[model samples]
Target chain A: MIPFRFSYHKPSSLSEAFEILSEDGAVPMLGGTDLVVKMRAKRVTPKVVVDLKFIDELHNVSFSEDEGLVIGAAVTMNELIEDFAVVKERFPVFYQAIKKVGAYQTRNRATVAGNIANSSPAADSVPPLLTYNAKVKVVSADGERLVELKDFFTGPGRNVLKPGEIIHSIIVPYESPSIGMYYKISRIKAVDLSTIGVALTIIDPDGKRDIRVALASVAPTPVRAFKAEDYIRDKELSASSVERFAELVQESTSPITDARGSKEYRWEMAKVLPKRILRELGLFEGVA
Target chain B: MTITLNVNGKNVQVDVQPNETLLDVLRNKLYITGPKEGCGNGECGACTILYNGKVVNSCLVLALEADGAEILTIEGLTKDGRLHPIQEAFIEENAFQCGFCTPGFVISTKALLDRNPNPSNEDIIEALAGNLCRCTGYQTILKAVKRAAEKLGVEK
Candidate 1:
């Protein structure tokens, strides 16, 4: 049984939810997949648990060519997988990362917003969201603001969100003409957290090739490989170039040794995954 | 606070604490013990149940969150003294040795079949990934799902 008790509030509107969030010791819950686990473990004991599922605006998953995709805080992973064709065709890296977030049962209730809001270093969704240049829309009684996914996290299990703020939606800008892929190294094939997750997006916007690479579980927060991305951008794909790119990618991580894997192993994988992904993308013709 | 939950096709109102889990309320107050609490956390899907037609770990769902929703547990799989086809298939296939994890597997399989009446082997494996079994080796359980799919007249 849960050891502690908290008052539950289900608000029907965004303003009402924001007002409830302003209460002292109040926590906003979207799917409760992560929060419930934490509550059971006594990691957090909020006096009030604000359930956000009742807010109509928080359940939407709308997309348009001009405005791109806006995933509401309550939109489940399964809902994103099933409803958004753009996720499948345009942002397949995000789709693949969502598939690895959890098993089907948990994914049925786990939300994209919660995945980011949790801010776990090993969270599978973060790297891909980073590659997509996603923006998090957070609301409070004060006002609303959009934080870029890159600048969202401050540390493991922490973000820039103020105590009174709750994420309203996540905005993914219009799909650029690009090829993207997500690669994750996990302990098991199913229902496991990522030991190392990588998302790479190669775009040729305005005839200038741009490469973006993001890695998870290799640092305090999911981070982009800026140096490595710059090194490979506009460069011809070659075995040596990709090898050097992987080396730069490895240099960017600051992983720690934990039960899941060793620091050294993660460092090596931080390099290996990018090379493997590049090979799979046919950017490199020969095995390195 | 009191919450009304639609369980097994019937609405039952029960007084539950704000932090009480749906599994706790179901087993303690409502006496719907079909869902077992193998792990209070969601890792073990022994408490799997259908919430609004989607399979979820009831242990992770707050009882208040379940209010105004429909839930189907292992006990609800039977109707008019007739076992669900999935349960019948499990029995015919000898899918359980200790039978402790049967309820969760049955519920998960029911959810999978409802969505994809004819699931492939990979699909079946993916759907049952969250549910674990210590007694049976899962081969018979796979066969049971296949048999149930055939019994439901949508075999692939």
Candidate 2:
């Protein structure tokens, strides 16, 4: 049980929620998947917990050809899974990555906004968002702004979010004729955190090939492997070229030795996983 | 905070602290102890319950969150003094030794069946992955789920 006493505020609108969040020691809560746990552990002792579920604007999920996909902060993992058709058709790699967020029950309560807001280095969803060049719509009583997902993180469990600023929604731009993949090494097959997560997206619209690669749990925050991506972009992903690309990707990581895995192991897997995924996708052919 | 909850088909009002969890309110104030607290955190699903017909760990849910919510605990599984089919199947299959995790398993099975009446073996495994049992080897639980599914009169 939580030992601290905290006031609860269930705001019915975005403005009201913003007002509540602007107060000192007030934290915005979406699904309570992360905040509640932190509260119970005394890691986050807020004087007031602002519940955002009552705000209708925060529960919306909309997609269009021009506007792309807009997923509100309150969209739960289960809601996304139920809308799998659109997600699979639009962002297949994101659909695959979100499916690995948590177990079924936890997903029922975990929200996409919370996962991104938590800013864990091993977050399963961040890498895919990076691959998609997603943007976070941050709002406050003052105003609103959109931050690129790549520049959102500042450190482990921290972001550039100012006090009273809440993530309103995530905006993923639509890409046609694209293919992507996400791979992660975890302790258990399911219901476990990622030791090293990798996501790759290749967009070939109008015959202009573009590749984006991102990794998680290998740095202070989730990062894109820009060097490897640039090295392999528009080039035939032959075995040797892909090997060199993987080495560059490995060089980009700065993983630390922890109880989950050794720094050497994470760095090695950072190289091996992308290559394995590339080979599986038939982008690279090699001898067995 | 004082909140009214629709629990087990009954509207009950209880006073709870803002920091209290749904599990705490269910066991302490409501006097419904079917939901066990094996892990206060959500890692273990022993505190699983149906919130708005979807399975969620009660320990992770705040008491304030359930103010106007409809909750179904293990105590609500029976009807007309007869055990639910899943409960009966558990008995016939001897699905539990400690029984601490049985409530969560039963609740999750109900949810799975409600969504997919004829779930494959892999489907059952995936649906029940969050609930952990130290005894009965889980094979018996699988058999019990199969039996329950059959008794629910859905084609395999």
Model 2 stretches with alpha carbons more than 4 Å out:
A205-209, B154-156
TM-score of chain A of each: 0.96, 0.96
Q: True interface contacts reproduced by each model, as a fraction?
A: 0.73, 0.71
Tens digits of per-residue lDDT, candidate 2, B1-156, equal 789999999998899888899999999888999999987778778999999989999998889978989999989989989999999999999999989999999999999999988899999988888898999879999999999999987533
- List the lowest-lDDT window of 10 residues for candidate 1 chain B: B147-156
**Candidate 1 on A1-288: residue-level lDDT in tens?**
678878999999988887888888999998888999999999999999999988988888888878878999999999898877778887878888898877888999899999999999988888887877889998888889989999999999999999889899999886576676889888877778888899987765346667788999999999999999889887887888888998998998999999889999999898888888878887777663
Q: Model 2: per-residue lDDT, tens digit, A20-44?
A: 8878899888888788888988999
**How many pairs of residues collide in each model?**
0, 0
RMSD of each: 1.8, 1.7
Q: What CAPRI grade goes to candidate 2?
A: medium
Share of reference contacts kept by candidate 2: 0.71
